[model samples]
Target: MALRGTNQEFGRPYNRRIVLESIRLHGPIARGDIARRVGLTVQTVSTIVRELEEHGYVLSVREEPRGRGLPPATLRINPEGGYAVGIHITPLGIDAALTNLSGDVIESAHREAPNATPDLAFDLIGAMVNDLTGLRPGGRVLGIGMALPGPFGVESMSFVGPTTMTGWKDVSLRERLAASTGLPAFFETDMAAAAMGERLYGLGTGYSEYYYLYFGVGLGGVMVHDGSALRGAWGNAGEIGHIPVVPGGEACPCGNRGCLERYLSLEARGRWSGSDADWVAEIGPVFRNAIAVVENLFDPETVILGGLASTDLLERLAGSATQLPNSVSARRDRASPRIIVGRGGQYAVLRGAAALAVSGVLSPRFGQMFTAERERGRDLLQGKGMAA
Candidate 1:
């Protein structure tokens, strides 16, 4: 949904996020334009902009008058206004990045912890957090965000399979990471986090609605609507990896035969023992089926494929995905490609992990006011979320 602001004084925080988002998306724009875009009065926009300027979050770009009375000053987000740390935990390693307000990575660190236990991962994460923080002289470190393999909180599907890390079934990542780093922590499934990162800082920008197909250790996807994730009831809505694609095909860890990931994931690619072209050809039908499923079910503006793989590999998949079966996205008036390779290279999830922290402080949510006071101390936003 398009962001709108309330005039109610109690909605100040919400309005503040709206104003900031306006500037982030459409700035260096005039105060008048922000007011019109967010449905706030010019007076309220002025007030919010002034407060943001005072807080060093918004920067005035042009103040010189053109002709008439004081020309409206265009505003933009201050790149140095804040910073956040992002951590991506995979079976192979943990990738960490420290990002500025504009999603630029200031510093990064990677440590391998193959099949890492929770304790070992936490220790490495703590060291990385310290290393990243030490590199920065001065800035507001908003918090930390983590992206992990998904199917979270389920007895059968969470943190137990070959694709996921073991000894983490009972670990409360948010609380433990927060206590360890002394900064509030947030987390999401790798797929959703990649989608969020793509939406905010990569090719998914300007496309309000899209489906992100994440090719990680396993296959996964996320649905974004109006610039927010449509996280389902249990927060594992996009576990497309486990969906049955082939009847009586390969047996998957999640107790399914012919799961999509069995034929379409990195694990599957690893098992191929063939060239990239051969792998692409092998999975072409399954990839097209997955795209058709995404298109028919979600009808997203576009489907973005990305993750811990090479750009060349993702490009190959994108090329194969174009000759798809009849789906809702097959339109003669299409303005964009049906499927495209994502940006940010392999750091998409890492950037998304950082975005979780940035979004918590700056992005507006629907029920934030009611929960803000209660959740202030916790700062535990999780999963594929709508807030960013």
Candidate 2:
């Protein structure tokens, strides 16, 4: 669902974020249009816009008037107002990206850290941040967003599996990153980060409710509802790779037999020597079954396929897995395709890691509904001598 703003005194920050969200999504937009879209008064929107301009978060643009008294000025995000760095960690390597307020990737770096420990990952991250920050001297860096392999807080799946990184479960990654980079640090699973990237700057932008099926080192998914990620109680909602698609399939380090990732992931494909087409043909049936399960379970507006895979491979997989099984998504009145590839490119997770900071700044949090007004993720931002 679209976010709406309230006129209450306590909701001022939320209103500001709501206005920023509107502008980021549709700008250069008139203040009147933003007011109508976000359920706020024109006066309230104007106040917020003025404050945003003073803070250098929004810029005013003018268009030629056809025959009006004066050309109206519109608002847009100021690309140089802020910057964010995103880091994606996996057993295979570490990826980092620096993005501006407009979500454009300005610089990126990749380093191999096979079976990386916390210390090793931190070292790589420090080098990346230093190099990235140098590109824009004295740039106002909003924060750092880190995407780690997940199933966090779970013993069996957190750090003891083939898909996840190990020797770092007890380390406070967020706090450490904040200290090392001298910036506020935000954290999320790689899957969640990828999904969040899609939500803010990719295919999920057009749909509030959609399933992001990530094709990374392993298969993962995230169900986004009302523009909020449906993170489970323990923050591992979309570990679909562990689901048993084959009754007696290959064994997974998670202690599951016939797990979906065993037959439908990059790691699975790497074990085979066949050509790309041959690999797709081999896993076509398994892929279709997984898609069917995702559709019936989430019933999202559409399912997005993306992540560390190449565009050609992702499209080939999407094309080859045809004749989809009948499910709730097969209704005749559907407005969107049942399946579509994400447009965030191969480094989507890295972009999402950056977006974590951007969203934290521009998007209102669902958690604010029950709690008193406060800075989002301030606990991580504070005590590190960083501004929130």
Candidate 3:
């Protein structure tokens, strides 16, 4: 009946995960720092560190001198601990990559997803994982993170929204992948993954609160607050595509009139412009209008324009947004939030999935299991018997 299940059974694993996550996020971090950051006592942090070091999931580096006191030893994640596979399932193809703890892509493979069905997609993904895992540096893969078109529910394995692909709705994607590949799997909306990618490795870094405006086949926004993606009640937060931008412009599939996606999305532009360049020119104003709406409502630190929208297009849109009327007249002196292009481009979603997978492995909730596994492996190598 418990949401997270029994604490007695999950406590150690949870703590270990937290410790590993702390190290991954702020590595070359001292034990004291990990303790402070993870909200655990020094003794608990020391215990976790010992476990990680024994397992080879983490390694202690040479002490760095700070003052007259003894130099503090730093800890870092071991890239060899495990590997994660990230797959971006776009309308065109399945772009996949294998990455380690450091987010370095070791290998990549792509296959067209043209008219892809759930069975065919899962089979291809399984084969891709097999091929990539065969070439892994240590021949061991931890898990897989899949990036799919929006409205994904891992519990139900249902995908809602406008997807050209079939057999996707209500498909237990994670279960199928796990069964086919024999590894744990995680699923995330492509836009949400892209947002995570930006936070970890792209422009969204440093800012704790921001919005990633994904403008691809459709338009959506990913909201981040205090370094975590804000999934509102029912996990439907940041559904900006449905936000009303035009009262009678165009009808949307979501049973709405003149939705933001109808104006700002590439699919909408395709009806207006025959090519990508033409779409960029025509959609800039619409994109600017959407930005103005977001700025006026959320007033985020920055609005990251991404999806398939080009950098030049985003810049022009940013310039145009400055001309829109502001309702908050009292805050006229406040500088408007900057609108910038996402750095990952077409691969942003996949990159974000990989990053998310890596984070899961290094997260404090799962760190202990990894640490225990690593320590067991290390003990075997050292000819020291591990605890049963």
Candidate 4:
């Protein structure tokens, strides 16, 4: 299978991204070291470095020579090189942030938007965008990345459903947000956005594949493979909220009985008054089964627990979880545990939303990686005088 990647182009752009990635991942590094690491000739690396410097994606700082020669120059990502606006529109409200090229949060704002009309929602987001971008003197906001509860635009789905945000049934979020904010918009399911957030800013940077279990007021997940979210048909791949964990438990808007979210989510728990012990016992089986299902289906290297729900609730769940059923991730010699607990909670999703924007501008996507490969193949053929 073609390795899933993104946002890279053939030739100079591809090389440029590599150089930037090196600086981003291990910054304040010298050009010669970068050339050695990325496997490029010194001259080629120098040319790309010069371009990066001219465009402001990198800043050069002088490094002391190890022993004798003149001090070397080091390159690091320029915090002001680029900017992106990340908006997380949840059932409760809109959370937004301005992130620099390095995925650092420069500024942030939040506005509650329960059942907010389209005009009101866009107005709030627009004002925040203006305020955020205003912080960066002359720096342009490249685009806006948004994450909201999903099954986006699905016909016959009721907006009044508990899992869905009200007043969003008739609105086209992408179009409205772009038009209102006057910037291009990218959209994702909240869980998907959380996964992207982790990938760019949290646990995801180290592992290429993992499952993100987001504990929004309800439960959901995002399957990330090789750093890109696995978008199922209709971009609703990780709608695990409706996964049937309770069989005959609770009536769900998705027309299922006993969805796992009913048992595991804070909203559902808030509806009852059982003791924590009794409650934990009731919820334990479902989470156990759900974790097993994730292992079997995704075979992720790690599973991260995140989202904007009760930390005590999630911590209890994570603490009580048992050894996973035999799956790809379960192994004896693994350096890190199969499961990772995320403490960022609500902020993680918001930061991840920002990461989506950062990713679009910074990450090397599969399309470009493939395009670069194709060009190389063409060059090989042309060198042999095989094809015009």
The C-alpha stretches of model 4 lying farther than 4 A from their native spots are 1-45, 70-74, 156-160, 274-278, 322-330, 362-388
* Residues 316-361 of candidate 4: C-alpha lDDT, one tens digit per residue: 7777776556776677778777677765556666667766656555
lDDT of each: 0.84, 0.84, 0.71, 0.74
What TM-score would you give candidate 1 relative to the actual structure?
0.88
Model 1: lDDT equals 0.84
- By lDDT, the better pick of 2 and 3 is 2
Q: Give the TM-score of each candidate.
A: 0.88, 0.87, 0.83, 0.80
Give the candidate order by descending TM-score.
Answer: 1, 2, 3, 4
Give the total clashing residue pairs for model 4: 7
lDDT of candidate 3 at residue 160, scale 0 to 100: 37
| Clash tally, candidates in order | 0, 1, 11, 7
In candidate 1, how many Å is residue 206 off?
3.2
For 310-350, candidate 3 gives per-residue lDDT tens digits of: 67766666666665555432264545456667676766777
Per-residue lDDT value at 37 in model 4 = 82
Report the Cα lDDT for residue 341, model 3: 73
lDDT of 3 at 163: 38
* lDDT-best of 1 and 3: 1
